[model samples]
Target: MTASLKRFAATLWQADGRRFPAPLSLLLVGPLVIGLCVAFILPVGRLLAVSVWNPDFTLAEFVHITESPLYLRILGRTFLLGGVVTVLTLVLAYPVAFLMARLSGWRLAVATACVLVPLWTSVLVRSYAWIIILQRNGLLNSILTGLGLTDAPLPLLYNELSVTIAMTHVLLPYMILPIWAALRTIPRDLPLAAQSLGANAVRVFFLVVLPLSLPGVASGVLMVFILSLGFYVTPALVGGPETLMVATLIGQQTTELLNWPFAGALAALLLGITLLLVTVFNRFLGLDKKAAS
Candidate 1:
């Protein structure tokens, strides 16, 4: 190995500063490759192994996951929540991202800071903050009651509504940043040129800007959906029993029931679903092609 590496290094220098041999390039990436194997591959391999193995090899855990209505319902709910959150984030983020892309100077800096500061805050803190605002007789309810919007406080906290609101707030930045990046790559001249050609502002945006920014939208959707699927803390704090997700169920299996095999099965199922969605996104939405461009 030492002699081969030496030969590869010598070949790299002989080619001047223009080109590198395959072996030399691989050597440069060796640390990154090893780190990925150690950090990601091994853990995933172990999780897959645990899903199939319970003392001896077995399929019972997976069978339970498939056969149990409770597990199935939670799994479905997790996907549904992820989809809803992704859509909500996209709707809220697009305008902000568009404005950020168009703005410059101190205005752009301030807008960027507004989006990033919340992301820098801890998720736990944000979730708890939502709890304070959404609870009965809390800030929202107090304001509503003062305005005589209703006779009494609304049931806001500890439900699906609160969960959706909090999760959307937490994940909004993920959607905005990618869309902003995609929008930034687009030249301002294209929109102006479209307008000069007699297209209205709305038509110019739809025909030119929106299509150009789809890559970022696709990226943001995929990221938010995946993150929402595995969310634990926010849902736990803000959501009621009716809004239980797969991740929460997995936690219960692992900690409360001491069912490692069942937990592994749940985790594997979630991982499989995530991979399936990514495949669909890449195939249908052309996310990979868009991102590359």
Candidate 2:
């Protein structure tokens, strides 16, 4: 087997002029590629087939979706929720990441723990934690009442605000870690150089820091937005019926209604849109190229 691999590597090296690494690398990655194709690609292809092939190839499921505004509206709402959560996480995470980048010793450890501890916790636990905090008589309301902020318990749970807050909390780490990684790569002298050039702190951040750290920002936005689009637990727990999203709608069709074909259609649609968004991000940010290197 060793001799056979050596021969194969030699043949590939001679066939390709680039380098031995270029042709010899496939052997290392070949098994994982095959595994993904068998486990993920084939199943997804079958899912797409199921959506359009009810007895025979037909567009009925897709046509039904287009004819009714409900699914499309829910999809739009999903995008809006994702955008809101992504923006919120970015705004909140950037400052946290900046602070983390500057800290050292125990302070750095504490900051890192603050970002990662919740990430290691269960999503269900976090969702329910929010429910407990935001419920009508839960933590926030009780504190508010004690402080004389309101005459009675506020309706905090089962609303868009509650959903947004929970999602922001859950997704905040995704935003933070990427920005932190990027911020860590920046040299300390760059900021000092900007200060020497008579640039104020705000100007230095916007002009120097922000542009240098854009790749991390792009990565964080992509992750948070994509995850938010498919969020089910947090929204379902803390949000009302009026706050329906694409994932919840898909879940209803798959389980309650037992409409697998329709559910498959919705799932396929979501998958398609997610792929398109990823492609757009790759095109704009060169993330794919950066990742490959």
Judged by lDDT, which candidate is best? 1
Best by TM-score, which number? 1
lDDT of every model, 2 decimals? 0.91, 0.89
Candidate 2's residue-wise lDDT over 165-281, tens digit each? Answer: 999999999999999998998899999999999999999999999987888998999999999998998888788688889888888887799988888898888998999989988
Candidate 1: count of backbone clashes, pairs at least 3 residues apart or interchain: 0
User: Candidate 2: which stretches are off by over 4 Å?
Assistant: 1-24, 285-293
Write the residue-wise lDDT of candidate 1 on 177-270 in tens digits. 9999999999989999999999998999899999999999998999999999999989988996778998898888888999887788889989
TM agreement with the true structure for every prediction: 0.91, 0.88
How far off is residue 260 in model 1, in Å? Answer: 0.8
* Per-prediction tally of clashes: 0, 0
RMSD of each: 3.2, 3.5
Candidate 2 lands at a TM-score of 0.88
